[model samples]
Target: MIKTRFTEMLGIKHPIMLAGMNWITTPKLVASVCNAGGLGIFASAAYSPEETRKHIREIRKLTNKPFGINQILIGPGAKENIDVAIEEKVPIINYSLGKPWFIDQVHAYGGKVMGTIAIARHAVRAAQLGCDMLAVTGHEAAAHGDVATSMVLIPLVASQVKIPLIAAGGFYDGRGLAAALVLGADAISMGTRFILTQESLVHDNFKQLCLMATEQDTLYSDVFDGMPGRALKSPGAEAMMKKGFSLLQSVKSALEVKRMLNLPLWKFIGLSWSMLKSKEGKGLLIQARSATGAISHLKAINEGDEKEGFLFAGQSVGGIHDIPTCKEVVERIVDEAEKRLKAVGKNVSA
Candidate 1:
């Protein structure tokens, strides 16, 4: 078996991780990955605080192994959801977008915090902020990757920080895992690959679409969710890119979001105001776009609506050919990584 700082840190058998895709990483999927000896991260961005707590409890019932929750710090209910996780003494908490204000709280309770960043400078800051590890995303990732690809970003961040790094984007197989290790990453996180797994809750229609996608089948733009991110090329994605900002659509989606979270009208408005004053100054436009994108994502995952819904997918979709169970994927990746590493070692002479 392959081992690294990530595996040792998380006490998992393999140096692989589920990428915590929103609406995709449910309790079942997360527990499956944990049971398969890999780190499974439940995405809590789509759920309310109560739902988050319920899901965490469900995961514990499914697997006694280590698992984590991924939260987007900039989203509404982020603090509440994180608070719920900490109250439950979760083993690990992973976050993306905005700074983690509860790192100390998590560490105080013997929990680790993982910060995800797509830029090298952010990696240093995250480590300085006491993040236990970093998930370094590359431009090839499905969502929110900056300009740097894994080839350039992983080693750059590795050279700048002492903590373990989980390389994400453009990684889908054992060859990718071995390559990440050589690139100075302790592990590799796979989003698109996991979405295609047998245990994934993604609709089979979208899975088939992903399987048929090529390396160039993804589109990256700020239109999808008011942030530069990649998504599978689909009619919905194309329409969003062309439609630009729609005040009416955004407002409707915003209301839908408020309903989904079951936030009091005053509380929802307060959250929006807080976001406006946040360090990033996201304001309501971004929030509205995000709400619309979230709905579209659900349509693709739950209803298989290809015309009006789209799924975030990485370039790695090109390399995935089968929908194996979580266990099969983990074992295959580790075994392949072992063979590739040994073969590469033999090719080198001192």
Candidate 2:
């Protein structure tokens, strides 16, 4: 009875969503989150068209519940991955980095498109582009924020967009969800909080660090991925800060993402340039920063070198202390939310 628009809109039992973390949200993890009553979002940015489908099938095999896919539209093979998702008739497609040109296609299939943005302007752009929902991520989010924290960004975007909004960043507890609802968001998405779940497949070392973190432990640095993203203060970030951008670094970083996507040279070059051209303004500068920072982004996923690799994280890491199962995590937050809502209702009645 404490349902929000998120539950009604997505047709899910709970309002919580698992943010797609690259190299971390495996099929097992995705299914676990879904089974636990939260919307599980698989990170398809790390996979190709076929690989994405395979994992989607794998998750389906584990649970009959609905789950979404997170697609980083700026990376190479992004278009192809989007095509595959459309063809497969995925339930929800969450995208970041660029405008979605395939919204109509997804709409035809009854699929929802949700754009993730850290800044208010981007949120407006996402709504204009016909996204069904907005996941308003803030600077306190683990990765890639232009500006604005959750408290400011959510309400700003909510004022502009007609669709439902989900708040991300600085969210890991029932209090965060209550605050987001008060701010006009229908629900909340959990990145760091989901990562702390037992189902996540990340490095134990990194997980340990996350457990030890506090809200103050996160730092925003362009050295992470040629863009300002939030993450735990680590030695890798420190080293990258010492180095600066160069043409060689730029090409290398582009190639790393390309290799991951298995994209041909022409498509890779064309799309990369296209994103830069469309973004224009400060976006071009953010794209340029990728030259020195991109390698660290990809390397961090591979566990190649912590000294050079950067982990995208959020300020909420400090608020987390244990690795609960996905179901427990979801139920805990949802239950708390329901309790608080009912308590507030009683006060109103009184």
Candidate 3:
């Protein structure tokens, strides 16, 4: 029953949100979260525009509750995906990696745009761009994250932005949600926590490893995709780190990703060229590093290749001990947060 600006704005009963994890957060999982009175976001970055539309419709079929779509603004077909979301009038459009070009278009349809940022300064810029909300990611997050931990970055961005903030990275339970609220976030977004859930499509081996992990079991490195990202320690990930790069693997993975997204060869080449010309895409080294992680992820998540594959995880891996249903996860978080808040109220009064 906890209500914040985020919950009210989205008309949801709780402030918990499932991070739009590529390949992991499917329509079934999204619908489960939405039906459980929390926000469920589908990762649209890995799919083609037609696939994105189909998933969106699938989510609609599963639940009448509000949901969202997350698109990586720097990747191939990013523009096409954005257009698909706009045309479908998706309730919430979440963008990461770059500035959104269609904020006004989203607003025109009464939709909200949420910008995900890891750096404190980016929050200010995203707010300036008319983002309705912000998902501030901390270094403790799985996958790609900035160096600032949630403790410092959440409040830092909160001070500078007027929009409601959704704190991400290292959040796992009700205690984390309560802590995020205290840190000035209106809500919290979790990726790894949701990945270990029953609804998640990740392989059982991956889930078991996370349950067995401690904070030290994860490493943050650029080996996976040449950019700094946090992933579980594995032979494959370790190899990437030692070698300092993965040229052949990256090429193969890039082709796989291209095929998965149904991106034509010309479009793929054009996308690569465009990225190379952009400020973020300056060097070929960055490109090489960035290209290797996707297929490894697919190997681990879809094929159960734990030894030669990468599993992006958060530092919260230390705190998670079991695989629960989405409903259980959300309910436990809400109940714990309520109790903690009440206890704090009493302590303050005393």
Across 1-350, the per-residue lDDT of candidate 3 in tens digits comes to 89999999999999999999888889999999999999999998878899899999999999999899998887688899999989989999999887789999999999999999999888999999899999999999998899999999999998999999999999999999999999999999999999999999999988888899998899998777777899987776787678777567677767877777788888888888888877755544555455567777888899878777888999999999999999999999999999999899888953
Q: What TM-score goes with each of the models? A: 0.98, 0.90, 0.97
TM-score order, best first, reads 1, 3, 2
Number of the top lDDT candidate: 1
lDDT of 2 at 280: 33
Instruction: Name the weakest run of 10 consecutive residues (lDDT summed) in model 3.
Output: 280-289
Question: Per-residue lDDT for 222 in model 2?
Answer: 64
For model 1, name the residue pairs that clash. Answer: none
The lDDT ranking, best first, is: 1, 3, 2
TM-score of 1: 0.98
Model 2 stretches with alpha carbons more than 4 Å out: 280-306, 348-350
Q: Candidates' lDDT values, in order? A: 0.92, 0.79, 0.89
Candidate 3: clashing pairs of residues: 225-289, 225-290, 226-289
Predicted candidate 1: what Cα RMSD to the true structure? 0.9
In model 2, the worst 10-residue window by lDDT is 279-288
Give me the runs in candidate 1 sitting further than 4 Å from their true place: none
* TM-score of candidate 3 against the unseen true structure: 0.97
For candidate 1, write residues 1-350 as lDDT tens digits.
Answer: 88799999888999999988888999999999999999999999889999999999999999999999999988688999999999999999999888899999998988999999998999999999999999999999998899999999999999999999999999988899999999999999999999999899999989999999999899999887888999999888888888887878887998999999988999989989988887764788889988888888889899989888889999998899999999999999999999999999999998
